[model samples]
Target chain A: EAGVTQFPSHSVIEKGQTVTLRCDPISGHDNLYWYRRVMGKEIKFLLHFVKESKQDESGMPNNRFLAERTGGTYSTLKVQPAELEDSGVYFCASSQGHWTGELFFGEGSRLTVL
Target chain B: GIQVEQSPPDLILQEGANSTLRCNFSDSVNNLQWFHQNPWGQLINLFYIPSGTKQNGRLSATTVATERYSLLYISSSQTTDSGVYFCAVGDSNAGKSTFGDGTTLTVKP
Candidate 1:
């Protein structure tokens, strides 16, 4: 089966600009998640979605960051007025509805905000 | 939020050598997973071991939930084994995990 896939493997944007990263999860998977890792930092959870609704988004850094799962098949994370510290690798992962399985992750989209 | 810490932030070993990586968490977890991120930046799940032990090929992992720790064993390491190992812990119900900083492993041939 095809694993989770992310678009625009790399993104470069000026500070204060807006950028969006997309992720297409595994077929039939009901759980989708977004995570990010800044340089020299651990990978941190951003949000979780079950189907088309968000399950938990407590990890969202701020209001400038937004994540949405449309139609429950794919997800998109957008950063508005991006700051230099927003540069990092954003990863998308998915698993079954039960959420007991290992998370299948994408190669990650590296965002560079200058 | 729970706290996760990994030991030996970095490691370097020759091919054919064995190494152990440790992870300690501050609270109880119902879900624990091991992941390997290759140099290309793909995070591949190695094990979903919350307790007990599991083995896959030359790599194995053991999670002592009672002690709130886990260990990943790499035997007969190879150049291809070079990457970052991350330990993630969370509850099975929520599926939101907090990850450790990871152990960067470099295997030299």
Candidate 2:
């Protein structure tokens, strides 16, 4: 089985620009999630998805960040008008919905907003 | 929301040495996982030990959900083991995983 894979391993953009990161989860996995970590900070949960439906998105930072999982296959996280504080590593993960308690994570996309 | 804390924020060991890392959570958790983040920022899953104990080669992990804590042990550590070890737990109530700050290990040859 293929592990979670992320696109654009690294992204650099100016403040106020927009960027979108993509994730292709393991096939047949129904639970997908997004997480991020700023420099020297613990990784923080961003959201969770059960199929194409968002199960929980309370951890999202603000309105500027948006996520979508179309057809419950892959996911995309978009950041509009990004800020300097948005510079961090964004990771996507997925797991089988059977409470197997295992989540496969992507390599992560490093975002640097100058 | 749960709080996950890892101890021994940083550790330095020589190759072949052994080390233990601890993780404490604020509440009950149904799932706990250990991950190794390489220098290049790739997270490699080490264990999905929610309870009991599991061993894989030179690495082992135990998560006592009853005590709300977990432990990771690395025996005969190698230079390839130099990286950050993270502990993440998923609360039964929230269904979301919270991660600790992680333990940075440096193994010198």
Q: List, residue by residue over A49-109, the lDDT tens digit for candidate 1.
A: 9899998998999999989888988999999989999999999999885775668889999
lDDT, candidate 1, at B77: 98
Local lDDT at B2 for model 1: 85
lDDT string for model 1 (B3-104, tens) is 999988999999999999999999888889999999988898999999999999999999999999999999999999999999998875567888999999
Per-candidate TM equals 0.95, 0.97
DockQ of each: 0.73, 0.71
lDDT of each: 0.92, 0.93
Query: Model 2, residue A4: what's the lDDT?
Result: 94
For model 2, residues B76-102, the per-residue Cα lDDT tens digits are 999999999999998767757999999
Q: How large is the C-alpha RMSD of every model relative to the true structure?
A: 1.4, 1.1
